[model samples]
Target: MKTQIFYFSSTGNSLCVARDIGNAIGGEVELIAIPGALKAPRPVTASAIGIVFPVYMWGLPALVRRFVEQLQIPASTYVFAVATCGGNAAGTLAQLRTLLEKKGILLALGEVIRMPGNYTPMYGAESERSQKKRFAKEKIAIRRIAPLIADRKAGKVDCGTWLGRRLLSGFVYNGGMKQVPASDVKFRSTEPCNGCGLCVKVCPVGNIVLVEGHPRWQHHCEQCMACLQWCPQVAIEFGGRTQGRRRYHHPECSASDFVW
Candidate 1:
């Protein structure tokens, strides 16, 4: 079946997973970057459709949620979703199922793949040992998931309590989403900034601009941390927390891979 995979990734973790799945499941696998697709979501008539993105605050990213909400999926198309996360997925799949149901799309598959954590505002990158462990697990999970997707498997998997999902969705996830728009203001470029304007180009939301040859945020941030994580000189910081912390991008993905 022809497959169209829609993916959003800041540090390239989700992007790598999407590509791996496409490679395994033979066909005309089209990988569409969610940020670019969000600009003009046209109807998709693929034999199968997939959405892959990172879990944010135990739920979907604000932009990812909106993209699914607005996406036009044909009723007959088989649909699946994969949530790549550092920790528990909580209600991410449940949240996505609800959104897709509203559009008359039954989510045929919902699963999570654990990956190294990159929520730098909260913590530093994982240690090399920890990351290696996670990546190994991720590869196994993808290998199993890709065939299921290729065969059009229908299933759902969720690992969280009803009460826990409610609390996280209502408090943590929702509150975290509110912070996304203003969070860009917290980003600061240190002395290492070279006016290269890479941040402006790397931002998925077009939220960064050059002011006096340094990057300035437009307050419409998605909190993906692309600009900060991909900065060549290790210059970008989120408030006082990320100045000296290690940055991480999926080792399997490169800057050119993210340009889509």
Candidate 2:
């Protein structure tokens, strides 16, 4: 059976999960970057489809939600999802189930995978020692999750702690969503930026461009922080909060791994 894994990752946590799942499924599999996928319209169908992405503000990333809404998927396809997050899954999978339900499609398996996080607004990047522990556990999770997906399991997948957090998550998530587009206004590069234009290249939404030897954010930002996390010179910062703090990208993933 053919499998198409559609993923969105700012720092590669979700990409790592998507890649692992693909390898474990062990058949014809292709990984598609969600941002790049949205650019060129085409028919997308497979025996199975996986939606793997990070949850933001306890919900779906802006672009990932749009992809789920617009993707041309068939009702019969075995649809599975893995939401990679720092702590809580919190109705993120439920939100996905709702979207698929609207199209008369079923989300066969929805699982949450915890990983090292990179949301700078909330805190500093995690330590290398801590990230290694998470990676080890993540491997074990993929080992267990792959067969269920391969066997085409059908049901809602949730962490025991996730159920209670949804009410609060939903409230904060909805309110936070409104600020996503203009949130980029808070990001500015420091003197270290030398017009490398790498930020422009790494921005998932193409929300950045170079003007006078510096990267500028357009209002359509996904708040993925790709430019900041991937910047080689460490020049990018979010409203001064990220200054002199660590940046994180999955150790297993590189700047070239993402398509856009």
Candidate 3:
């Protein structure tokens, strides 16, 4: 049975889980990039389909929400969704399940993998070390869940409560709907930016553009943090706020790790 994995990742955490599942099952993986970015074609025949992404504002990221609305999944394909979150999965899985059902697909499994939270706007650099420790712990836990995902097991995970959903949805839509405030979306340059333009090339939302050999965010960002997290020189910063912040990418994933 052919299985396909589709994912959306900003800091590469979701991509990490997707890659591990792909490796474990030895099935095809497709990345559902943010809108207006390159993407791969959906497979015509697959016994199982997987959707992986990080939770934003206790729900799906805006880019992933748009992608799910536009996605065309086959019927009765044994669909599954995996979410990576700093806390609980919240209502993200329920949201995906509803969206897929609207498209005539059944979500067979929904799993949330706890990972280090990277929302720099809400959480600052003070917790950087603790976040890394949580990430390490999550990685260890992922090993146990990987097998269940590979076997298409549908586990009864918590979906949070009505109030929790309302609160998260409100925060995400009102506070995180667009580019984070300038004070929040800070970036600075170190000595390592070689003007490679890789950051510009890999941005799914065209948030970063090169200016005089340095990359600058033109605002209108999705807060994916791909540039800062994926920069090779580690030169990018969000003002001085993110200085000394730990960059995170998927363990075995890179910019080219997922496409479309």
- Backbone clashes under 3 angstroms, per model: 0, 0, 9
RMSD, each candidate, Å?
1.4, 1.5, 3.8
In terms of lDDT, model 1 sits at 0.85
Per lDDT, the best of the predicted structures is: 2
> Against the true structure, what is each candidate's TM-score?
0.96, 0.95, 0.78
Give the runs in model 1 whose Cα sits over 4 Å from its true position.
none
Report the lDDT tens digits of candidate 1 across residue range 66-109: 89888876778899888999888888888888888888988998
Could you tell me which 10 consecutive residues in candidate 2 have the lowest summed lDDT? 159-168
Residue-level lDDT tens digits of model 2 in 80-192? 99999998778888888888899898888888888987888668888889999999999999998888888887756663345435564577888889999998999998998
* lDDT agreement with native, every candidate: 0.85, 0.86, 0.68
Residue-level lDDT tens digits of model 3 in 1-260: 67767677866778777776777765565544444332544434666777788887678777787777876656756777778987766677878878887888777777777877766634543355675776677666667666666676766554667766667754554565655534324666678889987778666666777889988877666667777777788777776466766666655566675322
Candidate 3 Cα lDDT to native: 0.68
Angstrom error of the Cα, residue 15, model 1: value is 0.6
Regions of model 3 farther than 4 Å from truth: 26-40, 121-153, 179-192, 254-260
Comparison by lDDT, 1 against 3, better one: 1
